[model samples]
Structure formats: structure tokens, C-alpha cells
Target: MPAGPPGKHNAQAGGLGSVPALGRPERRAESLAVAGLQPFSSVDFPGRLAAVVFLQGCPWRCGYCHNPGLQSRGPGAGPRWPELRDWLARRVGRLDGVVFSGGEPSLDPALPDVLDELRAMGYALGLHTAGLAPRRLAVLLPRLDWVGLDIKAAPTDAALHDRITGRRGSVRAVRESLALLRSGSVDFECRSTVHPAWFTDADVLRLVSELSSVPRHVLQLARLPDASGTARAPIAWPSAALLAEARVIRPDLQLRAA
Candidate 1:
């Protein structure tokens, strides 16, 4: 469940369709449009062995998005929610958790209900998001067990962030989400996917400094194109000096392969 593109998804925009109001359990469970499901994942939900649900539709269009197929709001080609639910029902105690990933899981109004269902079924819940919809996240906070929030760029560098996300006002939403997470009881972490072409050493340091209050911040190196021969640009890995300086700014910073 890697961070996907960010953009608003709604019925009018050809997204999954009209979002049902919160607390409407009758419709919420059926509203989800799942793009795919990873039956088992050890890395997605931190300590828990979990299943990752890839929801459809994201409003942003980051150039580095690997799941381009998921950026649209239309009906997906994967199993329907009911089918996935039935599948998960079978996993019960075998899986420790269920991670709602994206195409920005927060965009779907039904997410909270879906989380409710999963939690009731005895599975812990986790979310992966870019914080594009802070209000939605606020509603979801109480339902989540852990969250992996993506920090696209330094808070002050909105322009750079907009360029990466292909959308304006993203930084403001991310800031709001960060604030909410800071004040809440839920366990969470901030992560950044760094592509050397898009960020400099100074930028990384600044981003880390902005997240000083956060207990954990992870820096993930952008992935290289797969063997399918997709024409992705070559990646220049981060410099050791840059990583060292970032650690100085945020002593708890962790590095990982994307």
C-alpha cells in the first residue's frame, strides 16, 4: 500500500459515486470501490500481519505514481466490497489487521463504516494517506488503530508540494492533518518518498525539521521502474551526506527502500 496520487474524488468527478452521509451503516459497507487486494502483507501495518485494500480514485496526479490505473474514480476491475468482505471474514484470526490504502482511502465517505465493520470482525485497522482530506480524516481518526501519513514536502514549501502532487492547497490539508494527529491518541507516523530529482538535501532537512514533534519519520527512496519496461525516469538515490544531515534534524528518522 504505497502512497497514491492525490486529488478530489466525488460523484460529479466520476468518482466512486455519491458519498453517503456518515453513520449510514446501511450504505457505507457497499459504497467502497476496491481496486485490488493484497491477500497478505507483513510490511503494511507495522507490527501486524495484514491485508491491504487498495481503494479506487485519487484526485492528485503525481508524476511518479506507480499505480496510474488507480487514479480514476470509475468502477474498478477488482472484486466488489461484498466479495472482499466475505474473503476477509474467512481470514478472521489468521490476519491481525486490515490496512485501507489508496488512491487515498480518506476520500471515500464510506471508509469509516468499512473500518467499523472490519474492527468489529476482530481485525485492527490502519490507513495510508496523503492527508488530502483532513476533515474526512478527522472523522476517521477514532476508528483507526494506526495511520501512515505521507508528508509530500516541507510544510512551507507548498509550491514544491503542489508540483509533486499536481494540485494546489495540498500542503494546507497536510498541515491540518498533522495537527490533528499530533493532538490525538491514535498511533501514527509520517513518511516521505524522496526522489532525488524532486528534492534536495536542504529540502529533506527542512521537511524533517518541520516534523520535529513527531516521534517517528521515515524516508523512503523512490522505486525504480519495474521490468515491464515502463518509460520511467532513472532515479538518483539520496546522498549519504543528505541522509546524515536529515538525521541531525530529526534524530528518530528511519530510512527504507520504497
Candidate 2:
């Protein structure tokens, strides 16, 4: 996502920390720039039958980010929110929940209203986020039923974390968001995607150590989708050694790689 217009903190805010949504007004539902939609997904929201709404616009430029096309703001490739609402209405008993994935869903100010509508329809709400905006997450926390937070790096390792995210100071905001999740009643899971090219075994160990207090943690090996081109050499999954090591740090740690 481009830098926030002046007065709203951008990369320069306090020099290299995740920028917060400061002084921004609430966005309207019509303002939702949806990038894509998966009308049904059994995996996105855990055990529930659900749909995935991919929102547009993300400030970070993580190299391993799969949805690079969703990085920009404005009208996305999917139907607008009004159309989505109509679709959701048709899904009443067929779906148990809706998961909002991103381009950092928290960046959309109209999310609170979106949550209200989902609640009225009696659908559980789940959010997948990098937690770019702590203030926004703090407000949305109460409305969330499940959250999947991407822990890109250890919070204190600002330089490396920023390097991984291609956005300076993002760790600060993630840490704040994690703290809010911990202090709230919401059920959340923290996960990090690892590619040997960017992360070492020691890095994973350090991350797990830092996340020891979280109730659930997942470690997923990055995989290029089928459309990404089969000509490239097959990538190795995260080593079982690494998973074993992570489990040592947190016995309950879950491995999301296959």
C-alpha cells in the first residue's frame, strides 16, 4: 500500500516501526475494495464451513507474499460489498462463518460495520492479519471470533523483521496487536511462513521462543502455488528437524506444512 497521506503515520513514524492508523476516519462499506472471493472454504476458518473475503490494500511488501496483486488500494477484482452482502444472505444456513483475509483487512475503516452485519446474520467472524494497525485491531478484537495473526519476525528484532516485511517498523505494530489479543477473550493463533532462502533454523527457534506464551502457534513452509510455474525446481518443505525444534520450544506447536 502507498504511504498514508500526511498526518497519518507512514514508514517514517518514529523511524522504522509499523505505521499505525492515526487520525483516519471510518471508511464506508461501499468503500470496501475487495480483491477476490472464495465462496466456500473449509480450511480458512478452521472447522467451520466458511467463505473467504480477500480485501484489497496492504502497506507491507513481504517478498514471500502470495497475493502481490492485492497490495494496492481501490477497486479490486471481486464483487463489491453490496454484492457480497447479497451473496451472504443466500448463504444463511449453508455457511457457519466468514474469514476476512487481506491486503491487511485492518486497514479498512468500514470493517466494524461489516462485522456488525455478519453478527446480525449469525455468522462467526475470523480475520487473518499481519496486524498493521494496532488501534484498529484493538477496536475490532471484541467483534472477532477467531484470528490468525502472521508473526513475520520476533518483535524486538526490528531490523530483520523490517527486512522480511519490506516495511520498516512493522514489528512494533504486530507486537501491540499480539498484546491486545492476549489481553482479550478472542481465540487467536500466531503463525509464520518460512522459506529456507530467507529464514534459518535459528530464526525459527528464536521466533518460537518469543511466542512461547501464545496458546497456539503454527509454522508453515512457504509454497509457490500451482500457477506459479512448475518449471522452477521444487522447494523443500520446512525441515522436520525444524518442526521438532519448534515443538521443543512449545510442545503444543502446530505445523501447517504438508
Tell me, by TM-score, which candidate is best. 1
Estimated TM-score per prediction?
Answer: 0.86, 0.84
- Candidate RMSDs in Å, in order, are 6.5, 10.1
Best by lDDT: 1
lDDT of 1 by residue, 44-163 (tens): 899999988888899998767767778889655556676567667777889999998878889987788888888888899999998988999999999999999999998899999999
lDDT tens string, model 2, 81-171?
7657766766789999988887889888878888887788899999999988999998888888999899988767788789888987789
Cα lDDT, all candidates = 0.79, 0.75
Count of steric clashes across candidates, in order: 4, 5
